[model samples]
Target: MTQTAQLYRMVMEDHVCPYGLKSKDLLERQGFAVDDNHLSSREETDAFKKEHGVDTTPQTFIDGQRIGGHDALKKHFGQDVREEGETTYRPIIAIFSVAALMALALAVGSLGTVLHIRVLEWFIAISMCFLAVQKLQDVESFSTMFLNYDLLARKWVPYGKIYPFGEALAGILMVGGILPFLSVPVALFIGTIGAISVFKAVYIDKRELKCACVGGESNVPLGFVSLTENLMMIVMGLWMGTKAFLL
Candidate 1:
């Protein structure tokens, strides 16, 4: 019977809370007409919080009854609450999805025909570059994680730092159809090393960990995805190497 809800949320210059926006959207979606009250300054926010006896912004009320903050508002309305730091495969999925789209675009643009082999070639090249970019985002974090399982990185240490740049370089060269001699070796060596490392870690040692295939901060498991990535590189390397030899 409550058609209207009141929301008191922070909207200060330096401190607009994200939950406020979510709370507003939620209210609107649930067919509640919201009186969206904004505390537009630090003093106003603090005063409002003190008056309501609440520690957080985005306090919701229906019929003068306090419904609480964002999570509480959801709970009051019988909605499911998403927990913080939820693990998802979204990072790896996003990287591969973008790479696939890029590959398709290139295949359509350059050759005027979507050849299966060419599409595969582009996919591998773009995916490798994308993975390299992820690794490069936090190289220190990546290296520390990489050393846990990667044999080359565990021994040399510097290889962990250099690997991302090398992979990116090889991928770019492959995409450009240039310098197969350099690109092929780079891909083959690293891909082989990666496959072995993944095999030993997952199959032999039975170690469970997050994959550095997406990035150090990723939630992707350290098994199939990592193995697939390495295998793709190895296959692409061999294919490119053979093509170079034929020429």
Candidate 2:
């Protein structure tokens, strides 16, 4: 059995009982079998609460660790449960960055095949580079907007500090189209960091999060598609980095 499954078995004693009925339902939904008879007694529950620092019903115990009540459970399940107003622009930035690169590639290929002159290649390359830089700037601006404390829609999240500054730096490099050898590492690092930030923000803060990307207001869930985009950018960045610097 899974840890959550075992935890459910250990915590619920009477499925029909008032004390753990809600918790039992939640556990069942999470693929745990509920057997209330095996649950701790009322006196035992009080002691368990005291011993584990739990003062609420529907409290979860994951391998003896008190993961908290309903809010905690939702969080564990990757549901939206955060305080209001925690904004994240990582997705928007990521999408734009990839799109800019693709545009740059297309511009280069067209110029090389049609014009045949190296000058056209340089011109298209420069333009694409400029566009990439603009996209990077947009990402920064969006991230700043989300981080703004003055915005009422901005949430107070203490967890964003854990991400490294390297992520933003790497994004800047990708936009600048610099150092081909380092593109993969840069994109991967930035995307991974951004992905974690986005997921955590969405999962903890249960609400339709505003997209920081261009046209992000279209009402779309920032799900696996966004994550895949970042990963693809990393690959593209890596390829570009290699071709630009090495070949």
lDDT of each: 0.89, 0.48
- Tens digits of per-residue lDDT, candidate 2, 1-247, equal 5434433223444443453555567778888664443345667666766766767555666555666666676777788764654554544456556654555565566554433333332332333333334334544444443342212223534312312233444544554556545545655664555555556566555444544323222233455444444455555555565667677
- TM-score, cand. 1 vs. native: 0.89
Task: Kindly give the stretch of ten consecutive residues in candidate 2 with the minimal lDDT sum.
Answer: 157-166
lDDT of 1 at 90: 78
Candidate 1 C-alpha lDDT tens digits along 90-120 = 7878888988888888878887777768888
Query: Global lDDT for candidate 2?
Result: 0.48
TM-score of each: 0.89, 0.32
Worst 10 residues of 1 by lDDT: 80-89
Clashing pairs in 1: none
